[model samples]
Target: MHSYFGFLCLVSYFLKSLPQVLCQRTHANVLTNETDAFINRVLADWNSPGGIAVAVVRKDDQGAWNVETKGYGAATANGDKVTENTLFGIGSNSKLFTILATGLLINNATLSPRLEWTSKMASILPTWGLWDTTAAKEATIIDVMSHRTGLPGHDFSYKWSDDVPRLIEKMKYQRPSAEFRDVFQYSNNMYSVLSYLPTVLLPSKIPFTRYVKQTIFDRLNMTSTTYSFSVARSTGLLADGMARQGINFSDNPFGGIPRALPFWATAGNEDGNLVSGGAGIISNAVDLAIWLQTLLSNGLRPGTNESVIPAEVTEKVSAGVSVQAGAAQFPELSPLVYGGGAQRGTYRGHEILERGGSIPGFNTQVARLPFDNLGVAVLTNDNDYGSFIIQVIKGRLLDEALGLDKIDWHSRFKALALTTPPRATPRPTNASLPWTDFITLTGTYDNPGYGKFELCLIAPKHPGASRSCAALASNAPTILPGAVEADIPTFLAEWDNPGFSHIRLTHFNGNVFNLSTLSSFPANDSSKPYWTHGGDSSFSSGAYAEAAAEGRHVGIGFTGIWGAGAGVPGPIGSTVRERAEVWFHKIPYDMDFHLE
Candidate 1:
């Protein structure tokens, strides 16, 4: 069976490699009865509590296409459903524009990929140092585009204020999280560098926003897009702008009202400015379609005197960046790539140009099926479950645009359900006990990045091991799937065992001091004072019980620290690029647990 599957895959790849003839003939429509069923099923699985908005676009002929927009609740409740041209905040999908800006500069002979934009490289912005000295100095314009700056994913300590000088000053004291050319970390700060590139090249200094508007937006005629939140506010889009903030919630099949927070208006910078390489743009679907058309035409504008990106530069940008294989591992985040901030390779046998964005309120997706000259751009005011919708919708439409194997999206959803582990209730307090000594097991503990924890460790089976489990300090209930008991000392050490699916703890030494030491396996509902203090108190008691009772999903609540976004780490601010430092919270001292 493996050999047969491998042979089939090879055949698919060979067919995929062929130009238009075979590729066009084999296009499969994903909008069939089966496809519709699949779409509905996946949406239901991922939809959760909040509403969803979806849009689909496909190329029917060389110059022909159609667009369909659908909304599940928010729009329907207000008697206003989204249309083909409904504006969306395309979050970090705006980074591609930063790359495009670079391409434009190169085309105009104002920038060179080979030139090192460092102090020793004869560039003007020598003070704007690359994160690494040796290898960073050697990096060119292309490396920055690939997100290889040695900085950490974000700087949690810096403020996301609208002041550029403060950001630049703060960055001066910053350091690199990783060694240069060592690992691919998706550093939005690199764009902070790119955002300032125009200033370095210009005889007259220009803010990042002006550079984008004049060069990229003006040339492409993306009239609707702008980098300034003030402009968005003036245009009567404050509500929409606020809605685009990327607030996150539990991963339950029934998602709840997200922790909506007000976002400060920020000027677009090159890194995360109102116009930098990361997110910070708002535009409608129509203008973006033009942008897509330009990309599909390989840099050529639809009807114009210029190409949006030079062919060589476009290839340079598209060529895969060096990165570690397998998905990025961030707490609570589904695995995704850590290179260049987007998945750039082929998906489902098509050479796909893809990008997605997640901000406080906005979630967006843009993809181009180059072979079929098909492109799609989806933007939504709410991001709660937008990414899933984009993937499902795109998978369906691409099947139609290019003849490929019809995927049963519903079956995939079914497969998702089967794969999710079953939740178990904790063992009853009265079930069994070897020795119950709970006095000397509470105190404060600390780890650098994860922060401090207050623990009340208990020897549930006391007189068995040590009288006091030094390392296992928390007295908090230790909840696990199903129900099992072992020595507290041994369990605390191996709580993070490979076999365990879910385990939380209260560390007296500061890291997770109040998570899972009080309860035992799958307690559906308990009224113990589990958490007293420390960390961002984000989860509600009802929220946890509600999620666990559902069994389909389990929400392991982590305190809110800097860099809280899933996949995206640290805080985003208008600062120079710096080292990637993982942040941790401090634990309180009242709890009675001791360090080993």
Candidate 2:
């Protein structure tokens, strides 16, 4: 769902007008009650049904950290107030912890054979192999962590039955959008795979969750940051999540009316969460301030000689290994570059490093001005387009602190959001056949790496558009993807998977289908907390959400393959063959591999 092509187009019109407002700037100020008021205003202006907890921390003249943590708006729908300790899921900001843990392992004196950024994945991870065999052999820890692995996030491919091991074994099946090391392509699967390294390397061989809790969390005194929400909720401080329906870009500052989005069940006393290294974390502003303070203090606990992480660890994590996006229209922000887990570049000509994450309902922004010893953590329980609200708050504060010209973030965001729709994608050369031709196509489809899924037809709202695979058998269909279909569906293919809900597929032509679900499925129930896409524990969705929502572009596609070269992403330089999107193959009613 993440490709920012649409976002680029939305903001294109505003480029010519940037000079008009270049002179305007926000008055720099200390963190005070007035700053709290402005935050509440932004949340209300954005129509957020939930609140945010923000922590701004910086080192002072005495070289000790100064922290200001405050809460704004209602923590829950009924008006529970947010405070410094209100727990919220920090989403992919958890990735930074994973990266830091890797750094600690590298710095460990007792680890045999020693690991470094250049330590080859093939040597450490026996199961590590991609379509590009040579790339797999040569790819290092940095390549995978920095997202230079050439693979896009085929997020729905892995099932959690085997957790990280199954996720690792499935890598050869994922297709790459760019050549190896050629571009920045984000994939959570890689980070999850990194979780296995400690298991293989450590003498004690602890899992990632245990290692992180011991190595970093305990050292920093971040007592409340944990994977177990059961513990968090018991304190009655964990914030409930809320979200808007679809991406309805509008001139109205209000977004799609928000509904409650429930907290994840797996986060509470569950034995396994497959993507823990990638996204599993929940913390609040006050605790995260300690994290930021440690980062700003160069991996040491502020006001102490002790180190939570080695000083060189911060340097290693900050070195940019991949250029993420250069689409900046203004001079204030430079093209983004990513290293380890966070993104690093210049903001207002000063070096800045930041990253953001979101699942279904919550959004997180963790940023720092390393050179200036300043950091900010904003945990929000609402999701708007781009989680732009978090940025609006962060941008405003940073502009004031850095003494840069203040650009009207909200107006530009609103205007670009409400832009007239772009032209529809040109239809493919192949014409779509009648609805009758598509129903039997329903059944199990498989790739060795992605696992098997049964594609059954779900009933459509419009009787005229409905086709039934249920008639093929008396077996009742499982629960629908969402509450029910609203519009008449036509020749739709439906299936349930780990990552997406409220989704159906339209046959583009033949066996080719676009990824219709995670991109733009409408919100089913806005009155209560619910979300349609990026089902429970979907991490790092913010990277390509805007472009995918506006353009309805599907980087995730399914095309049936036949004949010899089926379901295989062949070797790197192999003849540049014109293979169909052969990621998934049609199988029989039973679990047989051969077609009927």
Candidate 3:
């Protein structure tokens, strides 16, 4: 979903020599009736299917690029048509700005990537308080940009009125899923909190907005882009500011009360705050082009025409540090990629880096083909519709402009979609035992460090707080760590995420129950019970011990201790499953932890 926000490929060309043509085409104009035709075709498609807005930019003569904008639909259901300068919620696409701004500080030697923000900032802003000593203090600037921070996407409870002081206070509870940088975990919480570094370092009373504006936006001439949600809303720059897409946005925690805007601004955790790496930022496609063009030129700021960030820093930003091959509770963007919210791939045979953003009525995609000095920035007010528009634009403009092949498969699929009947795929079942036999295995389990946990046999309507647990029971087994309990079926059946080579399920009486790897159990009728290797262990037991000793597999075991460590619980001792529930209750770590 999100992690591959930039990796998701809408279409690709079959042209083999596109790179050669791309090098030659530089400094040439991509504008013509042909370019317009391609744009129109895509715009027409967007209009019929209903899209918000779209814009594309390609290198023109003298290293300049032409930007084309089209407004097809409204931002909200009852909103107005999009305009060329229409502002859309950029979502995580704003991370680029944050990263670039941070890079500026590093370039000027004002900030150290290795310095501990908690220590230095604590001295400057004592009210910020010390973060959890566990793994929180150890996180560095590099960790946040690289998505190595252990904090989850939305681990801290945020409120609308919370200011910087609240964000610092929230950090005291921000614990890591593992040691700092141990694994690539995409964390918006980390990104938001990391901004504090600059705020505390600058002059005593300088606000973050002014600092960013003076350093990044103003330097780059991004006049329309803004960080203040309230300003954007008041200025009419942001469309449907407090709405959501795909599903209705909720304010109530208990389901009935209307909730205020979650107001991510309060999280203060860098990774999840309104301006965190996950979301926040309001800008138009025109302004985004100026931003993307700077990145394509390797940190060259607009207007002033100065190098805002060093070339080395630019290289570091482009070169991905974290590899999220298969992370649960992470985004499942495509069959092969996963991450926070964006996906990356190639277009017209040229290497392309891109990210997509969507929140209720907003959808956007930002792509750059640095090799060809070509980039596309699309901002829309609709969510999924932009995905299709992206495909059309890529196929029509990029492919034809580069003399490549268009993606006809998407068109073919759309045409054939009306005739294709939905398929009924049975759930995976473990023949060794019926689901009823495993009912006793469900209950609260307690561990020392990690805290309390549970696995209850819930009715379909009674899905609880463990987001992943409900997804496991539902037919949609897309095992993203914090996905709604209803969507796990998508992942359970498909080997889409990176880690899974293939999927196999053993069912009792033809009813799918137990899931396993396809390669491990080649034959379905084998009589032996196909127990999960180390990582799949329900509790810390002999299997877990074996895995730990070998260090070959990741097991689903508890982190903290509960009862006596010497022996297994007898009549008075509780099983590991019960202990797991207790740990769930005690521990408060983010479920959506992964690297992008």
Best by TM-score: 2
Kindly give the stretch of ten consecutive residues in candidate 3 with the minimal lDDT sum.
541-550
Higher-ranked by lDDT: 1 or 3:
1
lDDT of model 1 at position 320: 68
RMSD of each: 13.4, 11.3, 15.4
Where is model 2 poorest over a 10-residue stretch in terms of lDDT? 541-550
TM-score of each: 0.60, 0.79, 0.56
Model 3, which residues run further than 4 Å from truth? 1-50, 60-62, 75-79, 110-134, 168-180, 241-278, 326-349, 384-397, 409-596
Taking all chains together, the TM-score of candidate 2 against the true structure is: 0.79
Instruction: Give the least accurate 10-residue stretch of model 1, judged by summed lDDT.
Output: 542-551
Error of 1 at 226 (Å): 1.6
* Candidate scoring better on lDDT of 1 and 2: 2
Candidate 1 Cα outliers beyond 4 Å, as residue runs? 1-79, 110-124, 162-175, 233-252, 255-275, 324-342, 410-596
Off by over 4 Å in 2: 1-29, 245-257, 265-272, 327-329, 420-436, 459-498, 507-514, 518-582, 589-596
Each candidate's lDDT (Cα)?
0.47, 0.66, 0.46
